[model samples]
Target: MTKALNEFLESNLKELKDNGLYNEINVVEGANGAEITIDGRKMINLSSNNYLGLATNETLKQAAKSAVDSHGVGAGAVRTINGTLDLHVELEETLAKFKGTEAAIAYQSGFNCNMAAISAVMNKHDAILSDELNHASIIDGCRLSKAKIIRVKHSDMDDLRQKAKEAVESGQYNKVMYITDGVFSMDGDVAKLPEIVEIAEEFGLITYVDDAHGSGVMGKGAGTVKHFGLQDKIDFQIGTLSKAIGVVGGYVAGSQQLIDWLKVASRPFLFSTSLAPGDTKAITEAVQMLMDSTELHDKLWENGDYLKEGLKSLGFDIGHSETPITPCIIGDEKTTQQFSKRLMEEGVYAKSIVFPTVPKGTGRVRNMPTAAHTKEMLDEALKVYEKVGKELGVLS
Candidate 1:
């Protein structure tokens, strides 16, 4: 009986190693900024999701330090068990105002926010109409909810309407929800929120958008829902503080009733420890900076455009990207991996995305252009790209 488990594990492990699909985690040795040190060597970083460069901002650092001095290091307990600090309340209020929602609730991480928020609302009686290319968190959340999941083609509004209409007509579900990523991290494409909203209204579907990548990159730094002016229509707006906000946590913004329900009902929020005081303070200051000035956002866009244009000029397939996340599409997985390794050896740190993360044969090297990256830094990265491309015979 025990032999089956050992044989299965050994076979699968050998298969993964033999297929060249096993991942080797790279150690990022310094701060996650535009440039970083890895294995005692400095490299221009294009793998981070810090779109606004807020992760390393001086103002945010100072705010976090100050909060630590005042509020100590940890919350010490779960939110329902005396972990909800004053700073947590303040951060929720700020998030509500920022997202233009009546209320908001924070969680330990964006992944947990999805896990908590999705299961809190939907159950076996409910059905979820999710985008096929939605994030892994959304998929896990849907699984956790035990809701019947109907996958619509990526960004296909007509397909979404069809599924929503069919699910509602059946009358088997207590509620129908439509969930999507406001900005898909892999493809860097914006979701069709306006069309989705119209369909959701027609079918009475609960609308949910995970704007993890869109926050601080779209709508002048608010998000894709705000970009499309659908704040009043979408029921749940899920976002992360770890990325553009430059801190650590996640939040769900919606009506006061929804937030109130999540406060007591969401398992992650009730069971997990609240965000630390320092993280809360840093995120709040980052949000304030985003609201007060568009300098970083504008610079991020400029840098994105410059990198995209440069890569395109060098005859690389940079896929259908509308945001700062650019993908240099190299079809074969081994080739793409080799290309990325070459880039790393040349002092540019961009990882490769192969099968499973993206469609098979659509392997790519994803690049993120942050505001902290100077033009010279980008230029140098491009030169490395050129050299690597030439060496690998990927470019003429």
Candidate 2:
């Protein structure tokens, strides 16, 4: 390595360590589920995005195995060059139905989905009104399109309306699109889709909703837009097969014309290898399961409410979350890290999220209680919280 590069790396790493910003990843010894093993210690896992606990479901596992036996391990080539397998077509069709759209297109991953979807329509001649707290993928997607991006305050419909009016009326751009995450992943608040759709209609702004976190959790498993019954009103319904769907991939569900355009124009679909056969089949099964019953969804919400109540009763500042995601807010960054570490030491694995994942001075240990968590597991976790909170001086 060059001398300058080595110095830069060393100095930056030291600074991060000193400031408690360096994230040390933990390895799960077994499958990620309601519980996980880290360094040979079994613990209640609360930091996963596996909202429905389908990651290790018997049905999904069987589906993946059967697919691997029938189709092999890889897609072998970029989609446009012959990698589009039978499972890909089926998954896209299912996604379209799931999201209540005319058609849908699948991508290799959620991040790539954003990269492909945004640039497929919006261009430098256009403008995108994005939520300030949208996921990083959305931010990069806006940047990649080379469109002028105006940041709307987090979940502030008034700000969105004002910006939408300004961008559309200015006539400086050929088109304007407003994009937001259906569920704000960190705070767990939902996007104001009803008012947004009203504003969009009044100003003729294109509407885009990336419901990655909301896909399998909201709308009886459809998504946040579906939760609000705005399927017909929103132009773009983007989602991930990874999070609540419990597999790995992303998709865009929209009109037939939009799907047709994405097939040809989205760079990831055109240039990247498609999803593997096993993962695709597994994801398809997961979606079907969600569509089949609301047992899991209902249970997930039950557990979420249970955990939030427990944390709140113990005098921990669990933020207001509409969904099952719970965050115990610890004001200082280092203390937040310490709180998470202490939880792990006591046999629970809830990770600390700090700047720039969230704003500084608002550090937190976010918890995700899935349907698979039994009352016993959650009770134990709450006990640990009580112990940690008092010891750390977070609760009196």
Q: Count the backbone clashes (under 3 Å) in each candidate.
A: 0, 0
Q: Which candidate is the best by lDDT?
A: 2
- Give me the runs in candidate 2 sitting further than 4 Å from their true place: none
TM-score of each: 0.97, 0.99
Model 2 TM-score (2 dp): 0.99
Q: Write the per-residue lDDT of candidate 1 for residues 208-246, one digit (tens) a residue.
A: 999999989999999998899889999999999998888
Cα shift from native, residue 356, model 2 (Å): 0.8
Global local distance difference test of model 2:
0.94
Residue by residue across 1-396, what tens digits does model 2's lDDT show?
999999999999999999999999999998999999999999999999999999999999999999999999999998888898999999999889888999999988899989999998999999999999999999999999999999999888889889988998898999999999999989898999999999999999999999999999999889999999999999999988888888898999999999999999999999888899999999999999988899999999999999999999999887878999999999899999999999999999999999889999999999999999999999999999999999999999
Q: Rate the local accuracy (lDDT) of all candidates.
A: 0.92, 0.94
Worst 10 residues of 2 by lDDT: 238-247
Superposed on all Cα atoms, the candidates' RMSDs to the truth, in angstroms, are: 1.5, 0.7
